[model samples]
Target: MVIVLSAGKLILTPTELLCRLSSGATLRALPDDIRLVTTPPLLIADAGAVSWTLPLDGVECLDDITEFYGFAKE
Candidate 1:
């Protein structure tokens, strides 16, 4: 699980190891030559940094993110 700041709030979201391999909206060190499957289209900057908003709420737990990504802790 990874905590990301989105829309001014800290949201706990599932982090997939493979996601790191895919190219993001931000031109970070991600692999750009390959296509991705079943992944959320990320908003990235040219610098390879992810573009996210911090939510108004405080830090969230992984359980709270299940609805968004259908993730379940193993």
Candidate 2:
């Protein structure tokens, strides 16, 4: 499981192990370490096993996120 936060109109995706967030900025975190802090118009993520809020524009329940990646293989 991975947590994604949309930065403005931009969506950050990981290629293999690297996740690029912005120009010349990147972050690395294991999926299990991810936690969400929900607030209106912004969702905060706490990863890297540390207590911090990585602010995001939106949040979603785990179930709904499946389609965002792609349909499951048969």
Candidate 3:
């Protein structure tokens, strides 16, 4: 599944971590979720109970994703 975090539609903070998955909607998460997972190439984010491995290996949205999650560009 694909996640998109631009505005504050989704919430992922010290107190809360949320991800509402839809059939064909945008999936969003916080920076901390990914940081605790790994690096840029391996796009991973935790949704409390489970971890999501995004299938964006060579997509242009990677830049946007990195910026969105405050990931260090590699």
Q: What is the lDDT of residue 52 in candidate 2?
A: 34
For residues 10-52, could you state the per-residue lDDT of candidate 1 as single tens digits? 2223432122222233222222222212223222213234432
Off by over 4 Å in 3: 1-22, 25-28, 35-42, 57-59
Query: For model 3, which pairs clash?
Result: 3-27, 4-27
- Candidate of highest lDDT: 3
| Candidate 2 residue spans exceeding 4 A from truth | 1-18, 40-52, 60-74
By summed lDDT, the worst window of 10 consecutive residues in model 2 runs over: 8-17
Candidate 3 overall Cα lDDT vs. reference?
Answer: 0.49
| lDDT of candidate 3 at residue 11, scale 0 to 100 | 39
- Quantify how close model 1 is to the true structure by its C-alpha RMSD in Å: 12.5
TM-score of each: 0.21, 0.40, 0.41
| Candidate 1 vs candidate 3, TM-score winner | 3
Name the candidate that leads on TM-score: 3
RMSD of each: 12.5, 7.5, 6.8
Q: lDDT per residue, candidate 2, 1-74, as tens digits?
A: 35444532223243222344655566544433344334443323345354333455444532222233332211
Error of 1 at 72 (Å): 1.8
